[model samples]
Target: MNILITGASRGLGLALADESLKRGHSVIAAVRSPEHGGKLAELRERYGANVETAMFDVTDETAIARFAAGYAARGKRLEAIINNAAILTERGSSIEELDMTEVARTFDVNVLGPMRVVKHLLPLMDGTGGVIVNISSEAGSLHGAYGGDYAYGTSKTALNMFTEQLKHAVKPRGIAVYAVHPGWMKTDMGGSEAPGDPRTSASGILDLIERRTAPSRRFSFVDYSGSAMDI
Candidate 1:
């Protein structure tokens, strides 16, 4: 499978790129900073042609469109797109203490970012029949509501809605869309005390993709372990 992953510079995105390469799948590692390639550059060096890097900021629609046009020109087909680029802001702030600017930024990257990617790149998957994985979180679930972190939580909630709507629109094209909670991983976003590993989460997510596991002919919300998550 040819997979395109946003935010591939670090954390779960990087882990997912690595795991996909290990599984012998081609990867387009999309990172905001091409100069700060870090481990992704290493992966390209080690895997040679199996891995490639794409530069784009998910918040920038023009950049996304440019990348998409170039990709189409190259005649490359993507089997999956992992919308993993996101941001977490004002994690512990109370409602009164929240910064609205930060909240808007959060929604831009976490919600609209994936929406933009899918809009521009859906053409690449036209005939390939693929999967779209929006990296959501349990915080998004109204069934498991919590206090504080309103920015991150609500952005994910909106993302889940987008995923569902996109699923319905694209099911006719043989494409499946899902919102996945990748678990609390020990990454820069998840922090040091978190117990889950990005590597494990990436592997399980890829497994779910390869299997095309869905609850029915609808949008499914699931955890990294392939278990259903309450909406």
Candidate 2:
């Protein structure tokens, strides 16, 4: 299967690419900076033709548009798209200390970015039925909403909504959309104390996708382990 993954420069995204390649699947690794894509470069060197690097920022609509056009020109067909590009700003700010500007930027990347990617690239999935994974967070869940995560939390909530709506919109095409909360991993975002290994998370997620075992419901909010998350 041909898979496209945004934010493939590092962390969980990189792990996903690695795991996919190990499974002998072709990967289109999308990263914001090709200069900083050394790890991806290594993967390409090792995996050869199975790995292709694409440079584009999810926040740039024009860049995504251009990439989409070029991708279509190449007649590429994708079996999956993993919307993994995102930012975490105002991490622990309270309502009183919230920065509205940071909040807007968070929404732009975490929410609108995936929307733009889907809008432009959905055509590539045209006759090829597949899945779309939106990397969301448990912070987005209203089930146990807490304080101190105003920006990132809200952005993920909106992303979850987008995932739900997108599932319905693409149902006719036999495409499945899922909002996944990758467990806290020791990445730049999850910090040093995080316990979850990104490789484990990537393996489980790919397993879920490859096996087509996600819940057959209107919407699915799941953890990397394939357990249902409260929506």
Q: Pick the candidate with the highest lDDT.
A: 1
Clashing pairs in 1: none
Q: Please, what are the lDDT tens digits per residue for candidate 2 over residues 1-231? A: 999999998999999999999999999998887685788878988999999988899999899999989989988888899999899999888788888999999999999999999999899998988989999999999996888899998889999999989988998999988899999999999999999999999998787668546665555788887778887
Error of 1 at 40 (Å): 0.6
lDDT for each candidate structure: 0.91, 0.89
Clash pairs, model 2 backbone = none
lDDT of 1 by residue, 1-231 (tens): 999999998999999999999999999998887675677878988899999888899999999999999989998989999999999999999989999999999999999999999999999999988889999999999999999979999999999999989989998999988899999999999999999999999998898778745455344788987788988
Worst 10 residues of 1 by lDDT: 211-220
In candidate 2, position 188 carries an lDDT of: 96
lDDT of 1 at 31: 83
